[model samples]
Target: MKRERDHQFECGICGAEDRYLLHNVRHRTPSYRRLCTNCLLKDHRGLFCPFCFSVYEEPLPIDRSMCNKCPSISHKPCIPSNYPHHTPFICPSCSSPNFSFFNPTTNGDSPSGRIIDRDSARALVAAAKIAAVSMTKAAAMAKVEAEKRVKEATYAKKRAREALERLAYLAAKEKEIMEGKGGGSNYNGLYLAPPPPPPPQITGKVEK
Candidate 1:
């Protein structure tokens, strides 16, 4: 029969020898030093539910809720059902009315069945309306600015084209003057009348 040897490893945090270290290898490793199961749970004391005072082992879907007024945490299901739904849930320790329950279900009291104050609902609607109007105005202003820029660009292009055409016409006129054909005339401006035909060179010496 073969006997299995037990290999022991030391915990980095508690310095205790153990066969395995308590850690979640699948996700992120905790920043705290490696420790055994007991030490690890002790280090993360905040993970325990305030209502049940128990720590979760696996990544179970725990209904965690936080008090808005204070830093206390609790399990949502543990809160009493008779707690006021219209007002914010208050922390028992702080007594400040700012904590809110997560994922509140609708009860058959109103038409929408959602518990909401009339004043709060009106404020939300007013804020939404103001935001919509402001956005519409901003869009209109942006469109006007864009159209103005486009018109300015188009005018600048047209002016550039006209200047080029004028330059071309002046260049053509200058070339014509250099070639001695001013005012579109075919005769060269530099040509003389052939020096009066040289007096008809005498046939033999002249008539005696």
Candidate 2:
């Protein structure tokens, strides 16, 4: 145990890094995470014997043991016989059939329960907000892309219609020239007349 105390570790509650003794405050996990002096004295003051329902005093290290599932503490006499005597121990409250993971306490209002509940709730809310923001941005981008594709399609259709109209106009003019319907030669869709037979020869100016 003394060798374990030499290592620098972070407190389970406040996240302060320092050399401290180990305690199992974190829920669900069987392993014991480290706890600082401030957390043991300040936050975990309610740690008491679940069987006797009495708080342990100073010099409690000899008789007291922490639960592997939660921050619960127990005395030698309060400890159950079936429970194995080892580094990891489970208190009676945790071993009960009505045990709950989120609410680790009997009354659901314990100090550790409140911390876990509040943190879990805040995390869920933050995740929801981020997801909503991402979805909104994606929808907006999709709408813009859809509009751009529609505009491109409309422009392409208009260009195709204009090309068809130009082809129809040239075809009509070519047919007219080929059949001699214009009564003269047509140069590049332009019609020319025969020049009116040279204006009656215009001999010696006009007559009288």
Model 2 over residues 1-208: C-alpha lDDT tens digits? 7545544376676676554233334333223345543343334423445545454446565767777877777777766677656667776555665632222124456753334355333333333333344356566666897999999999999999999999999888787776775476678766776566555655577768
lDDT of 1 by residue, 29-52 (tens): 212233444334333334444344
Error of 2 at 157 (Å): 1.0
Model 1: ten consecutive residues of lowest lDDT = 23-32
Clashes of each: 0, 0
Error of 2 at 170 (Å): 1.5
Off by over 4 Å in 1: 1-116, 181-208
TM-score of each: 0.33, 0.33
Q: Number of clashing pairs, model 2?
A: 0
Which residue pairs clash in candidate 2? none
Model 2 TM-score relative to the real fold:
0.33
